[model samples]
Target: MQKSKSFAKYADAEAFRAAMEDDVRRGRYHDPHQESRLFADVAVEWLHGKLDLKASTRSRYERELRVYVNPKWGAVPLRAITRNGIQQWVEGLTTGDYPAELPDGRSPRPLRPRSIRNIVKVVMGGVLEYAHDQRWIVENPIEKVTTPRSWIRTTTRCI
Candidate 1:
């Protein structure tokens, strides 16, 4: 496929071309077209590819995607997802600070740390990892996201 970009200066254009060539040579080049695909589209594609998952596991993943991950990221392009954005989303999930209206028309309640972590891991992480594997992104941004820690307190027994 033919791709072209116009730079303000000849030197800038040459530098970009050289970098593209170097990336190609190193087998690190990603197709720009794939980067523009919406997260929802990619997530569906990823989910459909999980033929080995049990029925219950697939159902859970679908519910998580529909309820948690998609509301925040569905329309976003693959190239637009960032580590910082994912971190903020995690914080919101823990703090009950997400949008008041979900696609299902219910208010979102704050989730427990473990639930939040599961959503991040099994939903966002899974889809983004698939995107990375498909060369839609240079790297998986979810790798750097930090989930809220679940603090457990133990009471001491006095004899």
Candidate 2:
């Protein structure tokens, strides 16, 4: 992870603190999309490292790639993923088809939507937003799918 230089060159104590506070007061916390958008791999790499996030956030990205992504189309090249394909992927999650790995390295039951939605909301959401900014695609795959505070549960199990 790289140190944030988004705020710099303020020598005073109170004034510097105030200016930092102002940036947060506005909705301008971090702008990851201000860089090049045509390169998908670069954006992915940056999302893994360049973004200044917490440990749990980084773990969420890993989960997004593993639980929600890799078992299906991860092997395919990034350019081959079309808009419709992305839509289908999101829909697939609703069916509890997500693969799972046991602690003993054996494959377990597929994950429910409740387990999958967090990765979709946090991890995949960031990737889609970054891809949109990079101009790698016309629009974000996860666009219009708002993140919820809590996922809905079903009678059978967690949904």
Per-candidate clash tally: 0, 2
lDDT of 1 by residue, 87-155 (tens): 999889988887533655677889998889889977889999999888889999999788888899999
RMSD of each: 3.3, 12.7
Q: Which sections of candidate 2 miss by over 4 Å? A: 1-43, 82-84, 99-114, 144-159
Best by TM-score: 1
lDDT of 2 by residue, 1-159 (tens): 354444454566557678768866874444334333333354366466646778877776665666556566545544555566655655656654445433467644444555656656556556666655555545565666633345565677666
Whole-model Cα lDDT of every candidate shown, in order: 0.88, 0.55
State the weakest 10-residue window (summed lDDT) of model 1. Answer: 98-107
List of clashing residue pairs for candidate 2 = 37-134, 114-159
Query: What TM-score do all the candidates reach, one by one?
Result: 0.82, 0.50
**Cα lDDT for residue 62, candidate 2:** 68
